[model samples]
Target chain A: MATNTEITSRDSSAAERRGAGTAERRGNAGEPPIRPPVDIREDGEGITLCADMPGVSKDRLNLRVDGNTLVIEGTARLELAENEEALYADVRSSVYQRTFALSGELETGKIEATLKDGVLTVRIPKRLELRPRKIEVQAS
Target chain B: MFSIASSASDSLFDELWQLQQQVDELFGSWTSSSGGIRSLPRGSFPAVNIGHTPERVDVYLFAPGLDPKTLDISIQQNLLTVTGTREIPTEEQATYYRQERFSGEFRRVIALPEDIDPDRVHAKYRDGVVQIGVERREAARPRQIEIH
Candidate 1:
């Protein structure tokens, strides 16, 4: 199960709520914006973010980095047969939005992103100075 | 008459809520076969939405990043089972700070309120969601009679 901490932290912020509200208002009638579950990990190089964004294709997904925040938005496309009406619907079709706060150590300019099988993987490399380095000791 | 209808609807909602709780329990109590460790029961992943129309009942499973070939759907009596597995290629020498997406085999079984025609059941997976439609039995459908 995905941890709820990241979602809770972002959701409790007024700025994040405003961003979400703006996205919802731009969506189709009765459709609300959803925050896709995400997994963030740190490694020797930097951090990797994996987001589950099913039904969102390459063209429909958008990623932006502004200052210290990274914003992800995607629209899911679902097609239903003609003359079909939903009777019980737990899944609502809508846009996906999420934001992450990044530190200055990250090299935002070189961030790489890819989408496959509806999962989005983003690799944010660290600044050269932030990477751990080993110093050689002279033998006396 | 209005009171009777309202009460009937209330009962239906109650039944649905009970079923949801049962599903949560079933999925939560399972033991991991590989690790031999007990995993904490968490909220349902790949959440589902169930709806019914006069003609049939529709089930929508929200699962993304699933290969269509790996998905298995079976219906026996009033039970509907959906099974599938997801595999993510391991990154060489990459250590994770947090791992959340569910991987490995997963099976979910749901009980229907009425018997359905298996032959008429149709399922389609698109845009990361599986849509299953099961036709209600002839006897269960509403019927109209002519006055003599």
Candidate 2:
């Protein structure tokens, strides 16, 4: 029942709200307005993306580009102090999750993601057969 | 003489104390090492965020690259359990490369407060995130006192 424009507008508003607040206040439960900023630039035959996912370790993160949807899910387990009580009076955990729907031009199998200092950068190159090529005119 | 109201309050407190003791006894007798994994089979417990508002309790779970049909959720007593497994990616054409993704059985259990109405719980899954809203029972909701 929802139109695409309506959904996009809502997403934009949520993004704005996330941008307006402190990083901690950006996201809560049940909604995902806050996400690590990512820049996807087109290279000669591929795309390079850099995402800031602080506190996420290589063991806790997963990246999969299935079809046209790129799924990113991970856990950021905060170290509990030894002296602190087991029960939490405030937030119990921190989460870092994001999902992006990529365009058809993306080559899923060629994508590569690397985590460095909590930042995730993914490079996806187009298939050699998929890239556009200019044809030379046949000599008369 | 002690008022009847005071006696009733004392009885209620006693009941609550007994319930707490019973919960503690059951959980304590279990052989579960707290740090040991409680996952179902072949999946990992993704990150989750839980929030409590006055009227409702909200829970969000992050799990992608999973089939919704494979995911199972159940509420027994005050415990909410989510369990499922994801298929491992297998490719015959690609050369040797690094693989870093979880695929297996996973289970996550959350204890709900006594105030939550089990019958009023509603859940929805979208965009690989599961959201559950548990509404408080009517009797547990706060009402303004009327001035005589």
Q: Assess each prediction's global lDDT (C-alpha) against the native.
A: 0.67, 0.55
TM-score of each: 0.64, 0.46
lDDT per residue (tens digit) for residues B83-120 in model 2: 88856545453332334444578778877667888888
Task: Return the DockQ of model 2.
Answer: 0.04
Stretches of candidate 1 off by over 4 Å are: A1-32, A82-85, A128-130, B1-42, B52-56, B89-92, B112-115, B135-148
Best by the lDDT measure: 1
User: Which candidate leads the pack in DockQ?
Assistant: 1
DockQ of each: 0.31, 0.04
Candidate 1 overall lDDT versus native: 0.67
Per-residue lDDT for A104-131 in model 2, tens only?
7767766777765445767777878877
Per-candidate iRMS values, in order, are 8.4, 11.4
CA deviation > 4 Å runs, candidate 2: A1-18, A21-123, A126-140, B1-44
What is the TM-score of candidate 2?
A: 0.46
lDDT of 1 by residue, A1-140 (tens): 12112211133344454344334423233455677887787877899998888766665667777668998877765544343444333344457788889999998888888777578888899998889788899999
Best by TM-score: 1
